[model samples]
Target: MGLDFDWTDEERAYRARIRDFLRRELPPEWGDIARHGPGSKEQTDFSRTFCPKLAEAGLLVPHWPAEWGGADRPTWEHFILGEEMWASGEPRGAQYMNVNWIGPTLMRYGSDEQKQRYIPPMAKGQAIWCQGFSEPNAGSDLAALRTRAVRDGDDYVINGTKIWTSYAGLAETCFLLARTGGADTGKAGIAIFLVPMDTPGVEVRAIPSLIGHGDIHECFFTDVRVPASSRLGAEGEAWSIIRYSLANERVGIPRYELSARVLEEMVEDLKQQGRFDDPAIQIRAGEAAAACEAARLLTYRVVDQKARGGAPGPEANVARFAVVTADNSVTDFGLDFLPDFFSGLNRPGYLAHHERAIVAGIAAGAAEIQLNLIAHRFLDLPKVAS
Candidate 1:
C-alpha cells in the first residue's frame, strides 16, 4: 500500500484547536520573551503559568496514558502539538523536555516512588529539568564522561562538572549520568540519577554565551549526596535507557517547523522591500524551503515509526542530521538577505531562530556523531581503524 501524506480530518481539527488556544492565550510581549530563547528565565518563568493552562486545556500531555493526566491521545497528535508549539516560539520553554522525552523516560524506567514524585509535576507542566550529560571533555563522546558517583551506605556522593547544560540555572531537577564503575569502565559503568537541584553541594553557574540569558550553564556537582532510590535503573543500564531517551529527543522538537516559519517571514520582509523579484533571492529561498520540507518529511518518518510502535534506529540519526541542515539553511538564508535584522532587537523571531540554528548541530548530539551513526547503521559502512 502507498503512504498517505495528508492529515486526517480529525488531525487537522486537533492542530487547528491548538492554534486557537495559542492565539487566545499568548501575551503580546511573548515575542520579546521568546527571543531570549527557551532556556532564558523570561521564557521559563512564563512556562510556569502558560504550561499549566495548556494542561488545563488537555493540550500539554495528550499523548501520555489517561492514568498520567493525558487522554491517551495518538502519537501523531503529540507531534502535531509539538509542531504548533515550536512554530509559536515554544512558549512551553524548558518544560517541553518534560512533555517530550523526560516524562516518558521516567514512566518507562523510574520506580513507583520515583514516578509518583516526578511524573505528576511533569504531566501538569510544573516541572523544569536539565540534562546532565555533556562535560568539558566529553561533549559528543558521552561514554568518556568522568563524573563519578560513589556509593556511601544508602547515599551516593556525586562529583565533577557538566558544561553546556541547558536550563541548569532554573531547573528543579537534573536527569544526571555519572560513572559508577572503575576509571576505565566507559559506557558500561554509567548510571542515571534523578537529583534535585537544591541538594547541597550542587552548584550551577551561568555560562556567558550568545544563545540566550540563562541558556547554557556549568553545573558543578561537588560531593552531592542522594539516596540510592534516586537511581533510575541498575548500573550499566544507562546506555539502553539513554538510547531510548535520545531517540525520543532527536525527533521530538519540530525545529524545522520553526525554521519554515522563519523562512516565510524572511520572504515577506524581502517582498515588502521589493526584493522578492530578484531571481537569486527567490532561488535561495526555494532551496531553504526545500531543506525545511526535507527535514520535516524525514522527521515524520521517525514519528511514523514511533506511532507504529517500532523502535527508533538509525533513521533518527538521519532525521536529526536533516533537521540540523534545515536550521542552518534557513538561518544562512536570513543572514545573507536580511543582515539588518541580525544587528538589532527589532526582529526578535529572526534573532531567536539565528541563535538556535547556530547550535542545532552541537546540541542534542553533534552533527558529526549523527553522520557517524548514519554511516555505520543506516549506510552499513565499515568503521575506519584508528
Candidate 2:
C-alpha cells in the first residue's frame, strides 16, 4: 500500500505537542481575544505576551536557522505548527509574519547589523512589524505604489502613505517599500526600508473595518527620516525581495485548515439543533467540505514543494486561489444556515470566519490576479493586449 494521508509518528507527536501547549497556554478568554481578529490591538498585545512564552517553550521559530534562535527543524514541522495555529484562530497574531516570512526574509537579505537588530526580537516574539505595501493606488498592482524615499546625508527622507495596513496602529516597525528612483521607475526604482513606526513624522490612523477595529490602518509617513542602515537590500531590490516574501506569505496562513475546521464546527452545530438532516443542507455541507479538502490538497502540494527546497512558482498562485475558495465556501455555509450567528449574536468564530473569508480574495493579492497567473503560468495561455 502506498503511504496515504497518514503523518509520520514524529510529525504526529509534534502536532500533539503544539495542541497540548495551546490547551495549557491559552487564556480562558482566548475566544474573546481571537474574535477581535489577529490584527486587532487586543490580539496583537496578547501575542506579545503569549509568543515569548512560546519561544521559551521552543515552539516559536523552530523552523528558523539555529543562528536566529531556532532548532533548524524541517520545513514540514514549521508548516504543521502553522496549520495548528490557524485552526486555533492564530493566537500568534502579527508575530505569525515574523516566523512565517519576515524573519526569513531578513536572514537572507539583511546586513549583519540588520539581522542582529531585527531577527533576535522576532525570535523572542517581542516584535510586531506591519507590512507597508499597498498604497491608496497600489492595492493589487503593488508596483504602482507612489511612496518615495530620497537619499540624504546618512539618512533617507521617506514620504508616502500606506493604506489597509494591518497592525500599523501598534507595530513597532514597518517592512516598508518606497520608490527611491524617479516616479516612472515602477518596480525597478523600489526599495525596502525597515522603518521604525515611532519615528518623527510617521503617523497611523485606524480604519474601521469589518475585520475588526485596530486591524487595518492608514499609515502616513511625512518626511520620515531614518538612517541609511534601515534599508533591507540594495536600491531597486525591493521587487525581488517583496516577491520572495510574498511567496512565503502566499501559503503562510493555512486558511483552509481553519475553514475545514469551521465547516466541521458548523455541521456539528447543525446536528445539535437537528437542522442537519435536510437533504438540501447535507448536500451543501458535503460540497463545502469537498471545497475545503481541495484547498487543503492544493496548499499541501505547495508545502511539499517548499519542503523539497523548490522555489515557489505558479503553483503558489493556484494554492492561494484554492484557499480563498475554501474560505468562501465554509463561510457561505454558515451564513446560509446560521444567519443569527453573524447578526451580533456573539458567535465569534463564525463572525471572524465570515470577515476573514470576505477579505481572503483581496488580501495578499486579489483573486483575479491568481486567475491571471493561473492562465498565463499554469495553462500557458496568451495574455490579452490592453
Highest TM-score among the candidates is held by which one?
1
Across residues 33-129, which tens digit of lDDT does each residue of candidate 1 receive? 8888889889999999999999999999999999889999999999999999999999999999999899999989999999999999998889999
Clashing pairs in model 1? Answer: none
Itemize residue pairs with steric clashes in candidate 2: none
lDDT of 1 at 195: 97
What lDDT does model 2 reach? 0.91
| lDDT of each residue in 72-164, candidate 2, tens digit only | 999889999999999999999989999999999999999999999999999999999999998999898988989999999999999999999
Worst 10 residues of 1 by lDDT: 343-352
Q: Number of clashing pairs, model 1?
A: 0
